[model samples]
Target: MKLAYWMYAGPAHIGTLRIASSFKNVHAIMHAPLGDDYFNVMRSMLSRERNFTPVTTSVVDRNVLARGSQEKVVDNITRKDAEEHPDLIVLTPTCTSSILQEDLHNFVERAQLEAKSDVMLADVNHYRFNELQAADRTLHQIVQYYIEKARKKGELPEGKTEKPSVNIIGTSTLGFHNQHDCTELKRLMADLGIEVNTIIPEGASVSELKKMPRAWFNLVPYRELGLMAAVYLQEQFGTPYIDITPMGVVETARCIRKIQQVINEQGADVDYEDFINEQTLHVSQAAWFSRSIDCQNLTGKKAVVFGDNTHAAAVTKILAREMGIHVVWAGTYCKYDADWFREQVSEYCDEVLITDDHGEIGDAIARVEPSAIFGTQMERHVGKRLDIPCGVIASPIHVQNFPIGYKPFLGYEGTNQITDLIYNSFTLGMEDHLLEIFGGHDTKEVITKGISADSDLNWTKDGQAELNKIPGFVRGKVKRNTEKFARDRGFKEINAEVLYAAKEAVGA
Candidate 1:
């Protein structure tokens, strides 16, 4: 494996734990070492849950491994079942425990026979899958299990169809702005006369999961988490799903139209034209502000975006196509969806860097030197090192990313938030104008004259003019380097030849 300071996604078993902790009356039993249960911090600390997270670890310590046994798995499962009385118990092996060749399915079956709560084994192949894929596969398996249970109960031969309603299938624990996105989407759908049947893995119960097939369609917004489960529903229960992640004004409008089209296909007489118009006209101030002269100064400015697939694609679209910003660099750490990301951002991105390593991203940032950066916490650190402005837009984030305010990055409201973030991240208005006019705080001649007046270096007028041709951002650094070069040598003054010699010496 590769050594890295941070990871874009956790191990496969952590994905299963995320799904388990997201739901109510569901507990995850991890058969691994004591410290392997790091997901507890994400659920409790990141999500800021006051209640204890529903997860237990059957620590496989030296004593247990030396004895060639792991009786703690069953014991922990039984204890958690007795204490919590959860509706379901998800048993899984961690990345390290996968090497032990543990029969987790057999253990879950035995627990099912003994305990009142049902048991489901998340047989995640950690070597073949990662966090997003593992989470998707586990959720798909759980959905299949519930559908089979409904079939056994004679609910329907396959599944029952009902009125036009949508089941949101992507809200998970520690997702980027998940709770607010769910709330905004539900509000948008409700205003259009559509009812939300259930939102999976977020405040949803086992009973609600079984009712997933009753909805007219599924709303799978996130590209990383929920698309697999939606496809499973379509194959098993004839339920169609819409995969549209709304992030900016144009994308949010497209998502709304797609929802309307799906509802119409299901023989529903729904009209949201008035509501859409009203919301886009009055509620969406960001779109209106972009067209105004106040924001026109930001048009065609350069930006660099790096994040997960969903946010990266949406931000690229908004900045380049909608807001008239120039995208100097675009990339992501999500290698699973790299092809899709490239296809979506082909028009905007000149070069795409798809890897988990943050160093590559930092190199790209140094080369591009965009005015602003949109990325995660790691990119935030890189921007700080280079003195560039950055805003956190993706996951694997810090505690500050989880703000108490309702800052969603999903729909119309999210569009407003994005606009505000970009406005604040870059030099704007009179400040930008002044910096450009004054040569970034000091004119070239003034800086050179002041340096010569204070120091031993002397510059000819032509040399000073050539130095002034350099970009203002790096001009000061270049001048300092040139002075050091002259001082190091026996030269007492800096002319055009001296400046050119210094450039060669320092490899500027």
Candidate 2:
């Protein structure tokens, strides 16, 4: 594992906790040390969740380790059962606890016999999977288990609804605008004469999960999170699933037609052209904006995108194919999905990056010098350092990412939002040249000589005149660095010699 101060993802157990925390009436029982409970702080702080996150830590303190005792795990399970009375309780272990070689699954199964609730022991092999993979696997296992149970109970519905229905899978607590994505998807499906049977893993009850197979098909928007569950339902129960994430305008239109075609095969007639008319294009500004003269400002502008596989590929495609921006570099931290991401971005990017190291990504950004950046919050810092504007399109997000408005990065609304964000982020038209040409003449006093130099260090008239020769784009940076250097070195005022020395010192 990389020993970095920051990481793109948490450990595997945190992923399992995300699945357990997302749904209603489900609790997670974690076997870990006391410090491992810090995951709760992350959820509470980042999501600002009003209610307590549904997770109980079976604290394995030094005392328990010294005595080799595991009675605390059973006690915690019993306590959670008595207190929460959850319909489902998931059991998992942290990386440190995994080394104990304790049979966590067997223990949870036995505990279920004594408790009133059902328990699922998520057997996540930390050696093999990361956060997103673990989440996908755990959710899939729970979905299959509940589907099987419902089948045995004779609760599986026979015959489909009059209108075709689809279940939306893979929306979790920390997913990218998950609630808004679901809302947009429901709106789109409702417009197409299709019914939404249920949305899973977020605010879904165990009963809702059990009824997922009743839908005519499944819509797995996120490949990293819900594709496995959708594929399993299709293969095992013969329910069809459509794997497409409606990101940009073109992709969103394609996804709508694909869904229509799939349902049309099941005998529901749909005219895709009728839906993809001027009305649909009007729903997203990007469609018209791409052909407008304002878009000419973005022509040949380069962008570097780095994030999860889904957003990275989608943004790369939209930047190049839709908004007329050039994608000079595209990459992701999701290693498992690298091959698929590489294939998807082949037309835009010559090479695809697949790693979790922030330093490497920062270096890549420096090399590319993109006009705009689309990535996680870490990349935002890198862009700011390089004086490039960054629009966050993926996870490892900050509180600022969770906007209160209906900003989505999916469907028609998402295409609109993405295009607007890109337009606002990059330098438009000849603004930089205008600033450089007219910087020094109009703004004096404050702009040129607002503050008097100190007595000991003075700016000679020639040095001041020489500083004005620099372009406005770089003058501010040079001035700040020179001033900071003089302040640090006990210089009262800057002279010509000191100014040149400071310039050389700061690599200006």
**Candidate 2 lDDT (Cα, whole model)?**
0.80
Residue pair clashes in candidate 1: none
**What's every prediction's RMSD, in angstroms?**
6.4, 6.3
Off by over 4 Å in 1: 1-4, 156-162, 428-508
For model 2, residues 285-304, the per-residue Cα lDDT tens digits are 88898888878878998889
TM-score of 1: 0.85
lDDT of 1 at 410: 85
lDDT of each: 0.79, 0.80
The local lDDT score (0 to 100) that residue 402 gets in candidate 2 is: 70
